[model samples]
Target: MPKSVAGGTKWTYFASSNAQNSRSPEVLFDLLVSCSSEQGFSQVAYGALTDAEPTRRPEYLPAAVTVNFPSAWRERYAERRYNAIDPVVRRTTMQSAPFLWDQLAHKYQLQPGEMRVLNEAKEAGLKHGVTVPLFGPFGQLSVVSFASSFDDVDPEYRLSRLNALAWQSHHTFAEIAPSSEGKCHMKVALSEREKDCLRWVEEGKSSCEIGVILRVSENTVNFHLKNAMRKLETNSRTHCLAKAIRPGLI
Candidate 1:
């Protein structure tokens, strides 16, 4: 089914998944880049949040898989461990919506540290862009971001289109990339709120009902469920219930 998204964007659920199943992520990523080329995005980067290595570093920071971003920025980001302050990277695990870089910067009121990171990024020609975060079923997190030199970009229309395309690329990547152990080598830890949501889910409560019980927005309930799924490392709700039960979580 082709569903409507923000700004009248159309998403064909099966189309994105089926088209790139036969190919490699590298190939599929390049294919998406080619499509976005028409809109003047010269660079793209897809990062797997599962790459974080908090153990060996002086400060804990998640590593990433980046492509097409500027080499200078990449080096500096690592050297300074900027992941601690980069708003976009921090939000992907918590937020379901796609975010424009500047929007987040303002929302959090970019402190001096955050602003320095953004300033460096801007100097590297990554001044404007949108990041789409994807939470995979098996407790994995990834993000796809498109960057361009143009500052006068239209976020509403552009982000709506790019957000869908980013998911398409992500679904393609999941098909190709095998799960690997991280430095943590531990399962994702669910928050107390997520546990509450799962417990109600086990009791057959709908998301809306769960929201009412929890006194949060319906969307917040979905967010908690998605995060719980990522932590539980299961695609099916039934399987998640079983896994959580076996572990005595729910």
Candidate 2:
């Protein structure tokens, strides 16, 4: 049984054990519902993107999606193809930070269609929410949104707790519903030097130290690491190592 905190926040630790042990989608959905409800959100949605060009536009529909919103609202959203104009989907592609729904207007100049989507969402009972964006080992993007009926939600306090639950939900879903596009199993080829650099990186080595150990210049070590990152389709050193290690590329 999962234990609840005093104020109904921070349930990730309690749910994590079950999340890791279970491979059922129903179990994952139930966990999401329970955790979101505890935190005051009445609706929750999870969407994953795969096999699409890594663009910052909301042109592609999520390859996989699950939501607990009203059926009427869901039907309307799909019928109108609102994903193409959804500001939240667009923002998820551009960054990995968690954001409040109300903050979108302040961050970007909302287009007419995007503004309409937000406005219609409010009328559908999704007045306030926070969306947490998760990036996979591949360039895949997953977003989890927890929406509330009221406008007085405290985003700062809820974002961190909800973010943890979102990640656990993502991992559980990924295990049960592996990507059909085969991206997760695709093999990335790295040169001998690149693999060597990444192996050193896995050992907690700095670029300068790795250069000394490999008898190469610091710039040369960085060059190899950057190449490894490109081959793995990742942006940062940490992401590079993680992706490389996942497929045993290193």
Best by lDDT: 2
TM-score, cand. 1? 0.58
Q: List the residue pairs that clash in candidate 1.
A: 52-62, 52-63
**Which runs in model 2 stand beyond 4 Å of their true positions?**
1-22, 52-62, 179-250
Clash total of candidate 2: 0
Candidate 1, residues 132-247: lDDT per residue as tens digits? 87665456667778887777766556765566566544544444455322112345567788878766665556789989999999999998888777776655443354344333
Best by TM-score: 2
* TM-score for each model: 0.58, 0.62
Q: lDDT tens string, model 2, 62-179? A: 4545678777787799899998998988887776677888899998999999999999999999988889877775576777888988777776677655665665455446545544
